[model samples]
Target: MTSGYGHGLDRDRDPLRRYLSAWIGFSAGGHFSQALSVAIVLYAFSTQSVRALMGWPGSLAVLGTLVVLATLSLVGGRHHIEWHGILPVSLIALFGFMGLSVFWSEYTWATVGGVAYAVGFGALGIYLALGRDLVQVVRAFGDALRILLVVSLSLEVLSGLLIDQPIAFLGIQGNLAEGGPIQGISGTRNYLGFLATLAVITFAVEFLTRSVPRRQAVASGALALTALVFARSPATAIAVIVLIVAGVALNALRRAPESRRSLMQSVFAVIVVLGGALAYAGRSRLLDAVDATNDLSVRSLLWARIRELAAVHDIVGWGFVGQWPTEIFPYSTIIAPSGRPHETGLNAFFDIWLQLGLVGGLLLVVAGTLAFVRSWITASGHPIVAYVWPALVLVLIGVTAVAESFVLFEGTLMTFVAIATIAARKRSWRSRLPQAAGR
Candidate 1:
């Protein structure tokens, strides 16, 4: 019973420490995933002529993850593997492409890169969800996420505000009809809008779970919301606002007396249905209202184009990221000077649909949806933690579904799923501990 750190062999361990270590490890895994995803993306487009190559650090990181898995398997034995919750769905999404990949993909290298991306994202998501206290880990990760957003948003703002090269740097190539700083990251009013919505959602959830002063939370939330909006990105902000209202409405009903709770819930449900109807009816206005009109308008064009492309290659795809240029052409009117087409579809769903086809897209969507839903359900009792994080994740997923296909984007989605899995695992451990003691 010798404790590794101390002389006392019998000191009882703190569950919190175990939870934190696992959580941190899971978070680091996500960072690694992001770095890897970036490497893959950069490498995919990198021609031997241009010389955009991945360095030794990235190679070592990938090698390390493999080493860790190999060592873990060797020591713990492979049979100890546990595929918890929605992992199977992700596996199907990633590996199922193999069937189509065998025939359709023109270039073997591109196909390999595509598979690598899927495997990376799938592995990270499954590991986080099934193995890690992903809830707290996610909350902690939010801190870093916010900082990144702030930096990204700020960089975008400067490009739009202080600099003259708006098109190349900021990606706001078209006329800036709407006022304010240009949106960065995804670019365009709608792209920035969705990113902003995610920021607000993340901030709100973290704010609620935090033990910080109410004023501080409010100030921080307001600042984030402002910065997000300043980029003229409405999609992310709108999603956050909608989720907040939904969550608040749900909370109100839960705290109500048992008799009134049902009635309130029913009323809330009706409101949601009515709201949905209104949103659909005034989708344009709603988009404009949130300064996200571009998203609403462009999605239709992108969907049509992607569907047509998929029809041609119904099984696999045009070879992962390569399909983007060809498939996106129908939706895009603007051509780059380099002869590449530029269409800002701004929908993650379409991105996947074009890359993986119908079957893969469906499975990945289910898996991603389940990632948030599981977190939401597990954190139900801890309302502050459960509601916000899952809600934030949902908001991000929703926005991405419309604008970008992040299903196999190893960096962001993988990190999120990993944190979520960690949270769920912790809950399971706690529930079983007492039962095991009794036995």
Candidate 2:
């Protein structure tokens, strides 16, 4: 039998075969795959816009459709898939624990829905990581982010310049005319800043890899930086600084002689550890420098309340509702100082502990740590510039996760899953096992 294409007959001779071949190709890694990836990224990131425009049901419908399409795409492309040890065990354990929470959750229905929601996005992430090469993944990310950033800025212009009034539905405060703290379509300035930072990393990587024209990459990078500046997020400011340091460290490691690379890595690790200690010791000053004291003060209060609540169910947690179900008992009880219901625990670690318990929190930390370690190792050793994207992105996500639980939700969760899976596929010990027969 033939291994690929035609299946022994000329595709043109058999219309059904031609169509099937086209479908398979499209689903596997052709333009359809890329387009689907962009759609997923765009939808994941613009969830607020969807929710605002179409309501919860509509947003759920869109998510469900994307999941279904991702599944079909994976299945249709199954022959092209390398199924052996494709998923990271750490992620598997984490999600498995989330599913287990269903058995103990007071809100069983909510747990079920949350697990399903997370799994759907997880599946899409896996498809993205497995179906496309790293460069393709980066390109898809770049395309989606370009659209999001451009639209966000355009809307800001409309709200702040054209109409000179807030677009309340989309959360545009018409603040761009004042040089912004603009939220864009992300619903909050911090999230907009986070997305902008991601764009900058992705665009820079694209330029380094020569994936697109140098001019286009530079313009995209500039646009992302502009958004980051206008968003005025202190957390993002810190993340940008961390990213620059990580970038430099990675560059140095990659360029070191093979014999000294390991030693250099050790030195870098020591430096990072000492730097972290110093940062913590000077935390007050750092926060003041970033103008983040007010924000941290608010979060401190919220976190204190969450800690008290978490102690009530310290081991297993209130039970894994991915996003805080605001109407629920404990979550409903935890209101902000402004009398607004808190949507998340603000910190991903805190959110995990609150919902999934200490065990789940540990699992999350393990998963993230393993992913970062593996990606960092791969990036430092791999000659291709494309490999650096995952490592740097993990840094962005990890740093941002300190103050925002976006890592637990749609876009960020999906990206994390994809990066984790990609790194695992490259460096997993299980790769030594004999290949499985079929996907």
Candidate 3:
């Protein structure tokens, strides 16, 4: 009787142990982890569509699910993670400041929610950086962008050609037939253009690295260019010009002798500074050249109001709301000329100042600057074509942030976190410590 009872207990324990082992194996599988990474990217980029189709509750559910899966994968693959120098201290500082803002926030609950949202995406970004190789991350981005762009174009064709009406639900204007200014799945032409620009970079990297077939890369590039042309966003057009110049500079630097590369970098920095000054001085002409004069007029009005209001909370900020809680005080008062309540401050820097104050704004600057510098250096020295992707993506983000506040929320925020993490992992000084030496 005693032996039978012991055997029964053993059988019960075996089933539980087997189940745990299977879950660990599944989560640790290469294919499973790669698919999850792609899914996270896809969901991040398609957040607008997800919200539109499934509502906030549904979208949040999806985000939560991805976070859970990512956590599981990381745990299962714990052996691969280099914990010594994984995350940049700058990022932690910024996030910690955001959390601390809860004390001073008038809208405490909103700030709490906002911080949670920001951290959720930040965690997902960390997962991508730590869990996959840089090349694998690029390929995942390529796959996700390909699917998103194709769907965006197909939806445009359906609404603009077949139905001859807007898909108001998805914010698609059905303007493809009208020689768009199309809004694809991103809800605005500028956003679509931005995504297309990112896709162009990713697809190019994919081609350069031979991560995907040549024909596929060429076709993807063509598709991205098509989306960009139709989107007709002056901001994105400017970003593309900057991207081309940066790409040329990076290529040149990469080919230069190692000793001279430092001098070349300094020269490029001076040129960039001078170019920015010249662009500012020629602002009127530049605006006219891009047909963004009207857009500028609208933005100037909003920015003026933001400056006035931001002066009220110039230090710590009103709170850490990522996307503006337009229903609240101050934010509610900043209406666009079109009578619509403004959702963002239009400029990311201004938005940060208004929301998180100068402290948060400075933190952001430090984080972004460090990330770019590290990525640029890594790309210049590394032979792999894949390293170029992070640097170029940062350029796009920095340029676009001047006119749009997308970097502070959702997909752009997540991308920034991932790239920053990757750059830190590669170039952080902490990596030299004995604990991190092998990693």
Candidate 4:
């Protein structure tokens, strides 16, 4: 409506105002920069051998802390930690309980150290959630996993063709040098497999629900699938299958009536519990029937022996330290019995029970299950960008929890934290719907 002369005057007079406008738009640190920090941490862990030497872990923690603090400074302290509803409380209780266990911990300093990592990672998740939307969070992880996969593939090639021997210093195991499963840069077949599975699902969500470029998403998905096939891990394969089933089930559940959805959830829970009980009760017969080895592929025997060890501290657990000290009770027990030290329980629930006892383990189960249900329900019937990414990833995580310790382990713990944080952000549904629909 303004005259041409007035428009020219406006442009001429608003130079500093234009700069301020751009600065205001950018003051929040746009999506990709936030994604970059996450990607760096992810890639750092995948190539931890090099990162350890460079002290990247400490540096990342400091950097994340500074970013979080700076953001808080800009947006007032009280508003900074304002996490979503009751879900975070349960998680905080779980972590706080773990931290408090240090008082009774056999290895006090070790618990202190583990607690430090938990707190640091938890804070990072808060920062990530506070800064970005659910869709952005998914992209951050997708970008991180994409870069890490490329690094993994490249390192494997380098290790096989350029170096004949194991690069133990960098944790490169010359996986491609041999004909066995390609461990990628993760150094272990299972670890690489797990990471690849995560990548597959993350990229899948981005491709299906978000507006990622078709070529890029397709290429990323292919890379993840290639890694999955090359890694040749049964656990990873199982996780992928579960993701498929979950995605289909979730799609159907989304379409079903609310009453049916509620009933279906209950039925699913009952079946899972009953199925687990039946599997455990008949494991020996099942093993024999399958012509399994004496060790049942080296897991059953370990599990059986670990149970006896667990009974020693079965009530309250051995306390939440980073690792079972080889010289301590549980770890030391196996050294005498089997002539080797034991590290983990091999099963996620068992591992938690081993560290935090039945009480803590039960608490973790409740927290995780409630969080999963909350995320699923809140995200239900919402657009893809709102629900599909998190709901699917939670499915992968929940299913894998049966066999793997990704929930508590270092490399994937942040992934879990980010999921939990996003799931906790319930208010985002209403606030983000319009913006999401526009996308």
Where is model 1 poorest over a 10-residue stretch in terms of lDDT? Answer: 43-52
Clashing residue pairs for model 2: none
Clashing pairs in 4: none
Tens-place lDDT per residue, model 1, 1-439, is: 3456563432445665676556445535545434433333222212111221345456436534643552332233224444443333344545666435645666556567556655555454554344333334444444444554565555555555566345453354432334565544444454455445555665565566663456755765775666555665565556656777766765665466666755765787699789879878977777777766655555565567667766776655555652233343332433434565643334666666656667656766665665555554444344355444654556456645655554345445555555445444444344465567899
> Where's the lowest-lDDT run of ten residues in candidate 3?
430-439
RMSD after Cα superposition, model 3: 2.4
If scored against the real structure, what TM-score would every candidate get? 0.65, 0.93, 0.96, 0.78
Q: Which candidate is the best by lDDT?
A: 3
lDDT of each: 0.51, 0.91, 0.93, 0.67
lDDT of 3 by residue, 1-439 (tens): 9999999999999999998878877887899989999999999988999999899899999999999888888888998788887799999999999999999998999999989998989989998999999999999999999999999999999999999999999999998887999988999999999999999999999999999999999999999999999999999989998999999999999999999999999999999999999999999998898888999999999999999988999998999999988899888999998897899998999999998899989999999999999999999989898999999999999999999999998899999999999999989988888766566
Identify the runs in model 1 with alpha carbons over 4 angstroms from their true place: 1-95, 98-103, 126-132, 153-179, 184-195, 211-219, 253-274, 291-298, 315-339, 342-345, 379-387, 419-439
Task: Give the best candidate by TM-score.
Answer: 3
Question: How many clashes in each structure?
Answer: 27, 0, 0, 0
Q: Comparing 2 and 3 by lDDT, which wins?
A: 3
Residue 355, candidate 2: C-alpha displacement in angstroms: 0.5
lDDT of 2 by residue, 1-439 (tens): 4555665466546897677667656676577888998899899899999999999899999999888778768877888778888799999999999999999999999899999988878888888898788999999999999999999999999999999999999999999989999999999999999999999999999999999999999999999999999999999999999999999999998988888989988999999999999999999999999899999999999999999999999999989888889998889999998887899988999999999999999999999999999999999989998999999999999999899998887889999999999999998878877654243
How much is the lDDT of residue 222 in candidate 3? 99
Candidate 3: lDDT of 288?
A: 91
Cα deviation of 309, candidate 2, in Å: 0.7
